[model samples]
Target: MQPVVVPEPDGSVRVAGRRVPRGELPSVVASADAGARWTWDDTNRWYPALLAAGVRVERAHDLRLAHRILRRSALASWPEPDAPPGPWDTLPPTPLTAARDEPAMLFPAPGPGDDALEPDPVAELAVQDAVVAGSAAPGRLRLLLAAESAGALAAVEMFHAGLPWLADVHDAVLTEILGPRPRPGERPARLDELAHRIRAALDAPASLNPDSPRDLLRAIERAGVGARSLRKWELERLDHPVIEPLLEYKSLYRLLTANGWAWLDAWVRDGRFRSEYVVGGVVTGRWASSGGGALQLPKSVRRAVVADPGWTFVVADAAQLEPRVLAAMAGDEVMAAAGRGPDGRGADMYAGIVASGAVPTRELAKVGMLGAMYGGTTGSSGQVLPRLAKAFPRSLAFVDEAARAGERGEIVTTHLGRSSPLPGATWHEAQSGAYQDDAGDDDVAKARSYARSWGRFTRNFVVQGTAAEWALCWLASIRRRLWALGVSSSALDAGAVPAPFAGRPHLVFFVHDEIVVHTPADLADAVAAEVEAAAAEAGRLLFGDFPVQFPLSVAVARTYADAK
Candidate 1:
């Protein structure tokens, strides 16, 4: 029950603040003395500090958070091992550069007794705390959406700044917003509108010459103002006259690139629009796009994406993918087995992990196992995983290995060949030196650490990035298949495919880990099957061996929520 401490070679002991058996002390201490730092927990900001110290420390696979707390609290006074335990050191540190400071706890002070009060003072205190928290960062409520919006806005701002030609377009778009549509045959309604706006802006009559490149540029500039400030997600913004045309162009550009004019010609014949998606496009593995609004679909437009008469959409996903991957990686056999089906068989890989009683939730199963592997130091995985491991030793071993490697400053990699490199020599001297020493907090050392972290990032990138490639291939494959089917039929065949997604599925919508193909309802199920088969085929094509099993859950539905 006592805290773990390993004496470092430099005289100062690198304490784990975790439980250590007497027999293990000498080796652990020896490792610690060799400049090995304890990986307190996964969230420790001190990782860079450890790397800087020239410590080759590895995280203890079995350290718990509670034990870490006990150690930190005990070590809070430094060099003294008898101090009372504290909770702060067990948890991760708040980075100095973070936008907001941690909130303080609010509790009712000893006031009049609440036994006879109309309302409890404690409840009022809670409300005050909530308000304070909200006020501290009201934008946090929409931070995720806002982050994406910010990226798009940045792109637009950058484009506008770099492309002076766009100003004329913007001016034209503004003029069009205030002008009326023109009669057919005189000029297409869209061009006519643009002409009216350009004329008004110049204070004279002018018309858009469809054949002139300069005139086309003017027309585009006029039509683009609607989307200039896309952060306004309100319904009113959607109704703006300039908005639709700009979106249409953007969408058209994407379609044309993805399929070429040939595919677009065919899509027009069948009344179905296809969209392609890019998964794991964001650091968080959320979907993004090279082109098109793959993440954004208005319901009004969505309704128009019905499947052709005979097709149905078969949509599916791997249930609890990350959780299952964690369980498998952690070596939790019981959890892994629980991922099976009924009759004591593997049901869903994730659900089985839950059934194995390793953790109540799939996320916990993964996070907890990771916590354990990373020297959770203070019983961080809680009581669940340890107990589950009692019944599933095989499964837990993988996590133990990762933890050991991490503790040893060894980079762990995925199934692919991607490997992370060790930190440069500069980081070592800084840790051995004083906090104020020239070596300490050296910008070069800090920058090196950042680069080292990016190297570690590449370790995961191989697996996730390869997966993204497979998804893209699968999409392209199914898209081609669909096109071929349409071409063979008399009902569909015509126009040039759009860009970006040319020769690929018109990826109408995508979120991280999922895609929605806008195919005819009649062929939706068939397309879904094609997608599933292509995904599996993609795995084989890339890895040669299955490596890990790749399975997907598919569904047919009329609404996005239906997939859920």
Candidate 2:
């Protein structure tokens, strides 16, 4: 059964067209069957409130996320082809938190003719359901919508629960590296010393700040170092005393600015680092973070992520997700066989390629596979790609075919039926101009180059987008499995843990293919099994007997840094 939730003026919700009091919403949400999808106007607005109230819904059809998909997807047709977007298109995901770490104001100041509060959510959902049921590939589109909505729920839950953070540990690491956390508005003593050394090496006045690349570049040139830019790679080749301190300065400066003292004070609160997550933010269907640098955090600071006193983290990451996805997508038996480990558990795909004689070495095999999927036609990667094609012809040809179609400006769809955006007006004009009666050779060459560049994007898009879908399926399966593991009464109720996850094992962190679960100490082994089981379930759900394995590198440990 689907519950069409409409917000009522009385601060209650009309659930399934019946008035449900706001205070009683949790019980109503809890009574919803596991498979029932709660159709709402906007999940970012509705779900966060429910999570805060200790209610968690299993499935939902986020009208906002679903509308974006249907309105543009080549697979869906019920909303009418090329329909002009109205108020829906401009309505962005309500931010979970603003940049200042304060709760975001969900109710927006409406623009002229904007009646968002008065729209019939149930009617909109009916239209969406019809579009999916009448789609070119209903099953696939429906699956994609389900998975995307699941991701939306998970993202909000993660933000609300927050990642366990040890502030002292983070500060200690910073002090050890920077020689002490400097006073506010002052540089660390160690960084100041490095700045002095950089200035001395360049034989410049102390006024030339190393932090300013422009000043440092001119100073380095004046000192006869022949430096082009302050980029680390370009600086490393130069044999000069300045290179060492300058590079060190750059590194320390980055740490200081990106995740140093200010970051700690801002992001970490009440021992939980709550980074706002943006579901489906990336075009490839991968997640993107908003406030806090959770997704972009460096491994060095990972030690700060320590579990609670009586709990441990179960960290798991899928091995070579995109490559394995490509294998399953193309039905490449040789590639699929290589995806499994030598022990039949899991294998490094690059290593497996080497074992299959794709190239002379693992590194070459890795580059060759990347080049094929990424559309590299020259360089060392290009040189080794032919051998890889011979070893796994089906996988190579699959991406190559997508690239050709992209070159012709055709839309490419992901495995779960998410269609790629078509080329813009400029692209069509470029291609068309190249065919004009008096077109110049340079125009033709430029058009061809642009085509290859976009082709590369499409080639990688198909594989990456499909990999993202696999991750969604994987996480959704893990979520269901976790919910099945009822909260244990034996352990102390973890009050610091948020609603819905307080007394149970819950997901704390998620990257593209990696996840970390915070679980009670006694349940560590069980959680690990669940993680592996979910990986298998996700694989089966996507490819169903394709023989492609999304094996994980699993580790159970007290600190996140301890995970492999």
Candidate 3:
């Protein structure tokens, strides 16, 4: 390894005494020390010039090592390996090049045709502002900025991949980060009274008969309350003032449904209400709704959640999960190990990297891997990732194979029946025919090719799909546990039933991957334990030890934010 420093160039400063502009300094010379040799294929007429320069280059069948060296050089501005709370969007596309932003060539050849469309710079700034607004406070803003930026970038990637839903989710996330500022003279409405009524409606069945599922359903319907609509009204009323009327009118409709109340009622049956969720259910392999409103929840109703008299709700989720999965697939061991727990000990698999005195947040690991997996050949993540692969072979191999296949215009999948198909004949013809005739409509041909090429858009569907199943099992399992713990908090106790234990609580809410149980403060621990047990059992039921370990880590807090 060599430490070569090039001083910052001034206007018309020389590189090897050839005048260059400022910000462009002496370039570092590098060589591949291992793996496959490297080669360049000039589709853009750079081959003749490079040959003329007498610059030596080698082409290897597997150019992983040489490729990595080139990748590292591109990542010069990335954060240091030990930097705390590293940038999330480390691989964002650079907009300008050279002094005066003129495009300059570092290599012997001019670059290939640029594929990316120039982004609206003004819109990008507004997006950044929104991220700042949603974050907690001034102190927390910087860290959040990086995360939000990365999320936005990931959304862009998804958009390019033809996944509109994921793009929406990321957009929503951006809005959430830059949360709405407090409106003057308009305080949030009190929902406790409404919460009580909704709880009563939710509880009607228990009063009828504890064990009879039929009686419970009938009681629930008879109550004639629209809990879901009430929730919507409450949330809209608190924030978006204009939508209040529509929200209220919508709730009115729920009150009229013969099956609406019954739907809520059935969910609470058998002393437990379980909802099913589907992950990667969408064509782009993102999560989708199935039996319940698992993807969306109205928060006003969230507070009504009371544990069965004695039990408590326990919640947990993996952090920056997909990036870790991608790293593992890429055979970038440094990244996988960075994302993995040291000796597999804690909730954050990347906790090891943070603990080992490298970057702390998973965002760093995420950014590093994202750059490597995508064609972010010139960024910090690209540079650091190859070294990471060298350290962690098994995991890196996974993502590397995926990337290779992707580069070859191949689709790849996990060890399941779900698979990707290759492009049809139309794509092959467009490539060949366009070159023969001078009247080549490149845009039309590319569009046709893209449609045909969609056949090869493979994903590790097994992991994503099965992961969704696991979430469903967890939701159902915890819902059951909470129902068994129901305790009446109301003085009317009108619809309340006997507590599971002498002082246990009841289950109140079931959002995908999360459960809310309203329990007595003292019994919180016991209730939380039950929730944990149920979640673990759910994972076991679905996967049955098929190599990867799906585990749950829990937190017990007074509020939703606190729990997180």
Candidate 4:
């Protein structure tokens, strides 16, 4: 492997004794050794250009992402830079935009005080290397950084490939559900009808708009309906003439605003829907969508995600991911055994819990497990917690310890060392006020409630954060396998599909534990096998030889909705 080469601000690259001119970096990268890994300030800044120029790098070290991990990781002792916070310290991930036709340099030429703001990728990489080397768990920390950087690359590639979408299908679905797109500021025909019904039921005047929450609430109260909020669950329990129409109005309104005709026009282009995927956008290390609501695609709109003529989508969703991760993290073999079937393959862990007599039914087992991980200590969850704890003491104790630590205002680290943020000053002040000499009962009660809430946040943080790490590993592994598979396959015609991913099975969509890979129809089965293999590999990467299983529900379909 060659040493990491840093690109200068003027688009020049300096090798041993040679200088590559501006605008020639792409070709240089394309011809570099396959094993050589590129170290850049941000993958979003550099990879897009390389991909546009028909160039692809096998590996990369994203300094910005690595710095974020080391800055907060409890396992690493990050050395603060000598100068004040630079751009690398505060730089946001560049969002992928539909209109970006050219690549922008990450670090521009400095002028006056701008020198301090300029990021030095070589220095940043050195610092990250040193931090990881000196960390308490160097191996795991290294793996975490690698997976995170790989995820960044995959994110850029997915955005570049875009998700296969049919605008006609989307328009048709919207028209059927909302009764055609509304003109300019007017409501759809169906929404207008539902609004009128709601108004008549509430005995309100025609001027009342059902979209306004305050106005709707006031009208509901005036009509003698016992409703405090417009929430679906809350309204569902009430018996009133207005409840039915009001609920229906709210449901369709959400669909119209979130993924309606306007959204379709702005997001979907050509034959695909391109979304900006923010890696590590969530503190839990989960990805977030900056635009396009890619993470929250409603079921009504999912039917519009259609594959190309000769291609199909291989959708794989991990089953019981967080619980399985918890079982492995706690080294609870008993809990892990529940996820194994008679054939030694992965099975439903909740059913196994029921069979073990931990709970009377599978639903109770699921609720109890969710309660244990999420700090739900009331109602059905509360009722089954004791039995679950008795059955899986180790797993239950693991999250219990995290929750207690949170209540005490201590930071809890995930399995791979992504630590939770510390309690704020406001939280500390509340806790202190409760213990004051003249403190009243209200103060104590308020502090206790605040503590419990923070406890819940931390209780789920560890499990969710670790699950995200597992997901990153899963995506990274699948990405490499897909590239290799595509390179080795001969049946694919590179011209039939989009550039860069013309002949390959490429990842198009990912949310939490699920992923959709667009591939040739003939290779759909192979892609499904690889997706399943990646889950098991992610498990081993995180837990080593732990007997926990990370099973996937794999499906091959032409549309995203049918796969589900």
Top candidate (lDDT): 4
| Index of the highest-TM-score prediction | 4
Point out the worst 10-residue segment of candidate 2 by lDDT: 99-108
Give the runs in model 2 whose Cα sits over 4 Å from its true position: 9-12, 20-24, 31-35, 98-119, 341-343, 436-438
Single out the weakest 10-residue window by summed lDDT for candidate 3: 156-165
* lDDT for 119 (candidate 2): 63
When 2 and 3 are scored with lDDT, the better candidate is 2
Compared with the true structure, all predictions reach lDDT values of 0.38, 0.84, 0.37, 0.86
lDDT of 3 by residue, 1-564 (tens): 111121122223222333434223212112323221222111011111222232212111111111111112211122242355312223232221111123343222212432133222233333434433443332233322222222222221111111001222322332342222224432112222232333354554223432233653354345543323334544454443223433433343333221123334433332333333232335333444444353554343233233333334444664544444444334344544544464653246455555545444566555654554443445667665665455555554565555456435565543211233344576555555555746357755674555433422332332343333444445545545644655435322322332222233544443334445545666577677776676556535543442233345567755444465
| Regions more than 4 Å wrong, model 1 | 1-314, 323-336, 343-346, 360-383, 388-412, 420-512, 538-549
> Per-residue lDDT of 1-564 in model 1, one digit per residue for the tens?
112333222323334443443334344544544323232222122222222222222222112222231222211222234556433233332231121122110111223543232222233223323432443232321221222222222222111111001122222332343223223344334445554544454343354443354654455456553333333263135554544443443333333334333333332232333222222235323345443353554332333343333322345554544434444444444554565555542355545556656568866665654444333434546655676567557545555554444334465443221123343455444334434446445655655554444443443432343344444345444444544434213223212222222222233433444555544444555667776776656445444442334467777765444554
User: What digit string (tens of lDDT, one per residue) describes model 2 on residues 305-392?
Assistant: 9998888899999988899999999999899888785787778988888887778788887788888888877898989988888889
Among residues 3 or more apart in sequence or in different chains, the pairs in candidate 4 whose N, CA or C atoms overlap within 3 Å are none
Against the correct fold, how does model 4 do in TM-score?
0.96
In model 3, state the lDDT of residue 263: 38
Model 4, C-alpha of 445: deviation from truth (Å): 1.4
**Candidate 4 minimal-lDDT segment of 10 residues:** 101-110
